[model samples]
Target: MSVLRLVLGDQLSDDLSALKDLNPDVDTVLMAEVRDEATYVRHHQQKLALVFAAMRNHAERLKGRGVNVRYVRIDDADNSGSITGELARALDDGAHEAVVMTECGEWRLAEHLAAFAEGAGLPVEIREDRRFISSHDRFRRWASGKSQLRMEFFYREMRRETGILMDGDQPEGGRWNYDAENRKKLAKGVTPPDRLLIPPNAVAREAMGDVERLFGDHFGSLDGFGWATTAEEAEASLKHFLKDVLPSFGDWQDAMAEGQPWMWHGLISTSINLGLLDPLDVCKRAEAVYRAGKAPLNAVEGFIRQILGWREFVRGIYWLKAPEYRARNFLDADRKLPWFYWSGETDMACVADVVKTTRDNAYAHHIQRLMVTGNLALLLGVHPDQVDDWYMCVYADAYEWVEMPNTRGMALFADGGIVGSKPYAASGAYIDRMSDYCGACRYDVKSKSGDAACPFNRLYWGFLERNRGRLRDNVRLAMPYRTLEKFGEAKRKALAAEAEACRTLLGAAPME
Candidate 1:
């Protein structure tokens, strides 16, 4: 009995259950760098490089372990352009059945594989992806009969189930979330923690070149790419985070610094999302830090929530409302994504810094993502598709499943109130409080309308006015509604025009 076990770029686990019962003598493992996957979203150059290099490294690891591994590189002479094409070519050599672990993210890819399996007329076994703490069935059960889904409640349930931060069945410190304490910015003269940097080897460098040449016309830059490509390097990066950075990770997790891109951010998203590190293991490791009395309760708890709570919950929401989930557009915003999104030429310093960092490194922390780039896109009325694709392409951790919900629901409020109850729309004040980018910014964060006033401040009100009819029912938007009423028609029109003018200045420069 011969089996062909397929591994996706993100599914590089050595101990995948599908391989558990594999008769090595008869089983063959398959991995490929398909054009279909890369071009589907016009991903960042570094993203393509990292995934290909990581996949190549994983394939080598499997081969070294004596598994019959077959790898098809993107530039292979006989390569097929898609996953199914490669799979069909592999099947022609006579494989009785196929064993595949479920896809980590992206419903579209999963559907493609399922349809391919059916077309092949083989008993395709789709194994559950056990890497996550929350299962599909568990999410289904949790969401069943729920009128409104809230992350806080779901997070509490997870705390009980996992026994994390629990003291004899009660939450530690008598609280489930320490978000209030976690929101503090770095004090004056406080030095930020150093981040781990994995210098690319020859293979990754070559892959980077390939990506640059292929995706030259795409958004984001290829300069300053440094990401762990192998499992060993990924594990080392995680250990470094636990030892050096995790202590103050909570305080600065949401903080942004001007000219400083990696302010205590765990750059482990790419590695974790790529399957080099497991999220459960990451939580357990963070918990160990608390048990060892090395990291504070707030720091450990905050880190744990991102992985165990938010990460898992988002995955559940994605599966629960998928297919229809992609089409959800609560706000019905129709503006094209401003050219500045790609150029990073905006006058807003926070936007400039984050976008510049993204263009340079293909990375940014969640706060920089949500409150900075994502916030501007939503407030400025960039079309959801444009915003969604930009996010999906620019970030290293982005995949369709995670990026879509976080962008559409949390950032753009496109899903009305599914992933987030209300839009995370905010004036420049939020950026002023959270980041130093505003201090040196050309645009005044305080001003709502003048030429030197921050476009975000003006656009913030403009967004509320534009969406009042759609979002007026949301109780959370009441304050903004009142503020909009105070502005009246004339001021609102002037502000919208200023914002539109600012948007027009984007992408006026020639591409380098």
Candidate 2:
């Protein structure tokens, strides 16, 4: 019997489970640019262009291999604007006996597809997504009896299971993490190696035009759009990273510079998340580079941990604790996100710089996401939903499985201590140490209180004082809480008042 195979925008790999058993002549690969997925959270214009271009390219590659592919453009006259609607319309035409699809990344889409299958009265086979190193069952088995799921432990297990960076039975360099060595501040007169910018091919240019015309009012700019939209281009980008950027990646990975958005970063997450590159393959190549004495162990290990460790860990947590996980507001933060987040109109140099980069490229490195925008939101008590939505909408690599845990758990501490051992809360001091943005900032990063003080400075202490009841017992926060006690009630009140004034100036209503 003939079958219909479905491909999501992110599932662009030729080896995707849905296409493994394909009969090129009988099976029609169904790919659609649905409006529902595109406008789910008002995604950035560049994100829209990248996904669409990549999807289009993947479809053409399939067709060139003698596969019958039914591709639906977003602006098609008869387009149904929803995945389920498109699938139902296609099935009703009676070309295929059944529907076959690989499992989707998002819970919402997965549930919708499953329901559609049941309602349509057709035989549907949903295959496992094998692109990731760890399967859901494997992750669940690893986490079954554990009281607390720490990424470090999970990462160690992944290394043992995959034999990546392992010296027989032991870890390379006698350690699983090189994160400590990865925190060096960027030295003066030192610059990151030049990045290879992939120019927009004809397909990408068309997709860019479509995004500009259709999603003009989206959050990000479509100018200077340069992302790999196919597997070949993505592989080339990875090779460039291995050759030029990997050596210094560990030392300066956390360092941020003004007008240098891509500093020592791989910039391949968009491609990897889009199924253009396999995570295991990327990790192995980095290991090979280290083995060859090209890239340092710290840099290679740090890079490998991001994919084999954090990337896999987050996906596992998402699947393990989703649906309810999305509603988690452990801190009870109810404040609305400030308008400056979208407009990049803040006087805080760090926040503005990160926001501008996000708007321009649909990306910001981990440190910028974690310590700057994410840290400020945590300090200011922005609601978890607001924080999650902003993160998911702005980044090209942000699929819900990865974005939610990073935003709600790691960034905002919204899940309490599930994804992270402690809140990633810090004052302006942390920002000043890691980035040069504080040097150009209008507010004084050193000032602890008052109008001229950085908002982060006041908000840090204010957050500690405000949340002492919930966080005081935690061992990790004991020192900060003790310091708050040493400040006495009068100093605490003053700090709170300073935070209130700063929030008022920024037009953020106080969180109850």
Candidate 3:
């Protein structure tokens, strides 16, 4: 039978299941750059360029190997502007008897494709995407009866199942996690090594131009665009991280510095999510460094956990409880996202820096993402819909499968306690301890009540006080609740007032 195999932009791996039993003569690999997917969120300009460039490069590679690839450019004259429309266009020729594709990454797209498959002229087979450590069935089995789907416990299962960092049923170094060892702040005068920027090739430059012509009003800049656009370039970038950056990654994985956005990070998430780099292969490579004594256990283990544990765990949660999970708002945070999130026009140095980096590089390290942007949004009680849309629109590595759980569950705690036991809510002290931004900020990090005090401090207390009915019973937040209880009712009320004032300063007010 002649099969038309569909390859989504993110599914660029050569060994993708949809192409497992390909026939070069009769089977065609269908790849399209659809407008529906690109404009779904007004994504970062660089993100659009990166995916299209990577897709084009992967298509070329397949063609080089004599594979029949039916490629569709975003600007094609007869482009249908949607994936389902493109599929219908392809089937009009009656050139194939069956359609095969790996399941998609996002629920939005998955639902669209499922509905299309029900009435398509030919049989459709949506095969499992084998790129992840956990399948839908595997995650369902693990989360079957559990009351709380903690990532730590889920990570342990992945470690044992993959035998990564394992020494015959025991974790290497007699520990399953090195998170405590990985929280050191960046020491003064200890400059982070420079990140390697891969120049855009002709193919990438063309994709970048197309995104600009089509999406000039998108969220981010196209200048200084240096993401690797092919599997070969991605592998080179990974090797650079393993050799030069991985050694110091552990000590300052959570650290932030002024004027330094790429703080000892791997910078490979875009590649991994794009299927240019395999997650398991990347984890094993980091593990190999520990075995060879080239990198420390803390660094290797910390990095591996991000991919094998946290990355996989979030994907599972996204699929396991999505469509409804997207609307969850445990705190009923209804305020609009502050304007500075896009403009980097805030006096708060940490937020401005993170927004600037996100605008310029289409990237930021985890600390910048979590404690700075995400934390502030949580404290501000911005609606999950607004926060979720901003994240999906801004980051290059973001897709709904990975980004939603990280934003709603881990960052915002909108899912209550599904992905985390407690809200990651924190005061200015956490940022001051981890970053250099507070030193130059207009507001004092130490002051609590006055306008001169950092907004995060007041907002931190206010977030807890406002959500006390929901969060006070949480075991992890007991100490904070105890401290708040000692603050007297008057002090608690004052904290909430100050937080509202700060919100006004940031150009947002309490939701009506």
Candidate 4:
């Protein structure tokens, strides 16, 4: 009897530890392109294409290694288009046990796997995913007895664990984080380093065409589809980033420009999430670059912190609070996400540009995610479901485990102060300071009221007013709450009215 081991689209590496002891003659690898996975939330057409193409490439690679791979394509006649259905069919083909690497994201999928395996009357073992340096249990141990989980503390612990950028017992440059030195607005008259854009190969070109035909009605465009769909190409993209853009990555990591969507960003999140590149290796390589004087300490540390700290922290939070975590709506927001998130049609130039870039390429740097789309949604009181779905649908790197915490907790503030101490909700002034898109916009960035005021500014004050009781006790929000206190009743009412008018005017326009 042979063992049937399930491998998801994201679990693509040949180095997967779960495959170590497997007897090739007696082990079968099951990889599938299920319609349910693709259409679960009406994902962007490009996102669907990227995952499917990557899965096909990975399956072929495994088969080339003499692994028995039961690959199921979406167009296959007998395809069940569901993980359980596919797993059951595979099990019926004389498999005694199932082995799998733990899923990367989503409690829903994990629960489904557990239930399905139990019903199959077969032993199922989910081995630890060794791709990440930090384990869920290690994070839990570190978080124990701590009232608040901060990324900085968790990051330092990971540095000590991995010995990355450590100079014996002390950290390199004698500092833990150099974030303050990293935030400089883009200098004028300087051309950005050329980004590494992978021209789609044969597989991607075919997948792109298929996606356009099958998912024509899906939100977002496929004009700028240049992502690497194979491990070799993903590695090339990583090397290019480490060589060219990494030297300036820290300084401009937060900066946004008018037409530039990929700033100092490596644009490797999708590849990393899909198991094409190991996060530990990426961090190690960046640290090596810093030691060689090819990249600055600030740039290396900032980038590593994202992978070691934020990325690991969010995964822990997802596993710890999931199933229930997705339903949290601290603000009780119910407004539908405006349609602009899909259509990229908006009067606000910043919003339009960000959405347009996201539509064209399922890529937006952290600032664009946090300050532009996410901040506006939070200020306008959009429902967490709408915001989360929009985020999950639009980004290629999105998986429920990572995307949920980022969208609901970090971005939307729907989880209150769990993931963030204070709401990231901000007015248009923040956009003005961060990006060049504000100057060309018709809305007044500084205005807090009236029709000509930016909708973000108007809705920001209204959001604070509406959520005063919910957020007033938060020490971080005290300053904003105090400002709200000074406004007289009539003034407060006027601001709310103006915000309401903007909401009415832009109803469904923000989520297009």
Which 10 consecutive residues of model 1 have the lowest summed lDDT?
A: 503-512
Model 3 stretches astray by more than 4 angstroms: 510-512
lDDT of 1: 0.83
User: Which residue pairs clash in candidate 1?
Assistant: 330-414
TM-scores, one per candidate: 0.95, 0.99, 0.99, 0.97
TM-score, model 2 to reference: 0.99
Candidate 3 residues 1-512, lDDT tens each? 99999999999998999999999999999999999999999999999999999999999999999999999999999999999998998898998999999999999999999999999967999999999989999999999998879889999999999999999999999999999999998897899998888999999999999999999899999997999999999999999999999998999999999889898999999999999999999999999988999999999999999998899999999999988999999989989898899999988999999999999999998988888999999999999889999999999999998999999998999998998888899899999999889999999999986778899997888888889999999999999999999999998998888888887777766666
Candidate 4 runs further than 4 Å off? 95-101, 508-512
State the TM-score for model 4.
0.97
* TM-score, model 3 to reference: 0.99
The model with the greater lDDT, 3 or 4, is 3
lDDT of 2 at 352: 92
Predicted candidate 2 versus true structure: per-residue lDDT over 1-512, tens digit per residue: 89999999999987999999999878999999999999988999999999999999999999899999999999999999999999988887888998999999999899999899888787999999999999999999999999899999999999999999999999998988989998977899998788997898899999999998999999989886889999999999999999999998999989998888999999999999999999999999999999999999999999999999999999999999988999999999988899899999989898899999999989899999999999989988899989899998999899999999999999999999989988999998888888888888899999987878888988898888888888999899999999999999999998788877777777677545
Please list the C-alpha lDDT of all candidates, in the order they appear: 0.83, 0.92, 0.93, 0.85
What residue pairs clash in candidate 2, if any at all?
Answer: none
Model 1 misses residue 9 by how many Å? 0.3
Candidate 1 regions with alpha-carbon error over 4 angstroms: 99-101, 486-512
Could you tell me the lDDT of residue 142 within candidate 2? 91
Evaluate candidate 4 by giving its C-alpha RMSD to the native, one decimal.
1.9
Model 1 lDDT per residue over 377-396, tens place? 88767778888888988988
